[model samples]
Target: MTIERFILFSITAISLASLFYIPKEKYRQALVSFLIFQAFTWPGTILLVQFGKIEFPVREFTQATQVGFTTNYLFYPMIFVWFVIMYPSKACLTKRFLHYFIFVSFSVWFINFTTIYTALENPLAGTLFSQTTRSYITFFAYYYISHGFIVWFSKKSNLSIGG
Candidate 1:
């Protein structure tokens, strides 16, 4: 198996395993940190290469574009978790689009600019993102599943949203 596939499998396994341990609130914090770590690595790596000219030691082994901290990973899961986590505390405004769209539009626009620049220099290094492929099953798909369980699991325990 390739590195990317291995990472994907490991992410799936660990993410699934996270569900069973949610009764203990402490683990959830660790889980969130771990997920954030997974999200941060690739984009951060590509950014470091583009700006700093750091020659990282690794071969390109995979081309799966549908998942794994590309562009869309952060946004949708934030949306899913936002609703469930905030629930009654953070009031969902009637015009949800008004609040959320600007953030997405700006992020996509800004990131696309960077992507264009980076792709010109090092094409294979960065996450070549598109709209539909953002919703990949391998990565963020678990968030929706875990979001529901997390909401339910956290509700059962004394855990608040952030913790």
Candidate 2:
């Protein structure tokens, strides 16, 4: 297997192990967010290497010294949305998460397209990463929205998998 795949598989295994360490019921509230963080960051990074477009030749830029961002940087924090949705308590955590989600996501997108992530770009993926400080926030918004779905799904499914 490629180095990227090996690294990704390792991360996935570790994340699953984390899940095992926590109690399903208690963790369910924050499960989606945590899982998303793991899923998108490392695994997503691998996928970007595997399937997402890259600018430099794989071998030469092993360090991606010439490139700006690795694939996982932008996708990492999206778990916030999931945090919002899957927040199992009767408390208003979901509402708070939504507010933060909207704020953080917009901020990341605005910053990115505007200039924040300008320096963070990979030479190879000049525009492929499409990340700016603002883009990071947008990704968070995605996480919040996804968490909403996870919450909705778990409830609808009537399964305690997500608590």
- The top-ranked prediction according to TM-score is 2
Q: What is the lDDT of residue 134 in candidate 1?
A: 38
Cα shift from native, residue 162, model 1 (Å): 26
Per-residue lDDT of model 1, residues 34-103, tens digit only: 3543354345445555665333222233354212243234433343333343344354665443434443
Candidate 1, poorest ten consecutive residues by summed lDDT = 131-140
User: Per-residue lDDT tens digits of candidate 2, residues 1-163?
Assistant: 7654444455445544555645556566555554555554444444544554432232224664432232243323332433454454555878766665555665355334323233332333445355443346445645656556656756755457867
Q: What is the lDDT for 158 in model 1?
A: 66
| Model number with the top lDDT | 2
TM-scores for every candidate against the unseen true structure: 0.30, 0.38
Note the Cα lDDT for every prediction shown: 0.41, 0.46
